[model samples]
Target: MPLAVGPYGQSQPSCFVKMGFVMGCAVGMAAGALFGTFSCLRIGMRSRELMGGIGKTMMQSGGTFSTYMAIGMDIRC
Candidate 1:
């Protein structure tokens, strides 16, 4: 038996290349989202720990902003 070429006939190599590209893109997006969420949660936890015992005195005094900035800068690098 002989197979005839159709309108969309192509070689196997092209299909494999396309599949590899699609899979790579999906994996990269998933990894990036996971890391981004983890980093955000870490930042939130750090902020909460810093603001723990001080209560109203420090909140009204505006020292919280400095603590947050310091933590954020450390996380950036």
Candidate 2:
């Protein structure tokens, strides 16, 4: 197969494409984790105001579990 010419008519290596793909995935993972953390904090606050200590703890645990699951999807992603 012939190499594709880049914008400046130079041969472009596919490694840059691979690097960009990896970077995109890392950014996506970080965004998901950050959003999950924010959601967990919000849910924790609400649960604390509406329930007892045990209930609050349970909510926090659930939130953490979900966040972990999302972050753990890196390989699948």
Candidate 3:
């Protein structure tokens, strides 16, 4: 007996679609779990350094802002 093909000339069963969906969900969940763990560790380790760097950046920004304000005041006078 000859096999019948669908419109695309391929005979794919419904099981294949269900299996693919289940596998996709499993893979996505696994990846999300791994990434969440990694992100937690990454942030925990860098939190102190991040705060220090932010403080330094704020100081530098303040100095630059004061300089620009002075320049504007001089231009106005």
Candidate 4:
């Protein structure tokens, strides 16, 4: 059951989409942070570059994850 109808017959499909997006974003950001840190270190990035690289990596990963997650959950529903 993807949805639970209310007494008034309202369907709230956004709930599942939101849930997937939030969860995926969190997971992706964490993974990105870990991998980005190691990658930047391996590349011998200075402190300034390290922070910027990590931030960029995190945003890219988060967006990718969230988009796929939202679409997947929507399809599952």
Give each prediction's root-mean-square deviation over alpha carbons: 18.9, 11.5, 24.8, 3.6
- TM-score of each candidate structure, all chains considered together: 0.36, 0.37, 0.38, 0.80
Looking at model 3, report the run of 10 residues with the lowest lDDT sum.
Answer: 12-21
Off by over 4 Å in 3: 1-45
Backbone clash numbers for all candidates listed = 0, 0, 0, 0
C-alpha lDDT of candidate 2 relative to the true structure: 0.53
Judging by TM-score, tell me the better candidate of 3 and 4: 4
Candidate 3: deviation at residue 42, Å?
11
lDDT of each: 0.44, 0.53, 0.50, 0.88
For residues 1-77, what per-residue lDDT tens digits would candidate 2 score against the true structure? Answer: 45778999997645444454555555555555565556656667445453454444444555555445454443344
Flag the better candidate by TM-score, 2 or 3: 3
Candidate 2 Cα deviation (angstroms), residue 42: 1.4
Best-fitting candidate, measured by TM-score? 4
lDDT of 3 by residue, 4-54 (tens): 468988964344344444454454445544554465456673676655544
Q: Identify the runs in model 1 with alpha carbons over 4 angstroms from their true place.
A: 1-13, 44-77
> Which residues of candidate 4, in runs, are more than 4 Å off?
1-13
Scored against the true structure, residue 29 in model 1 reaches a CA lDDT of: 47
Q: Rank the candidates by lDDT, best first.
A: 4, 2, 3, 1
lDDT of 3 at 34: 56
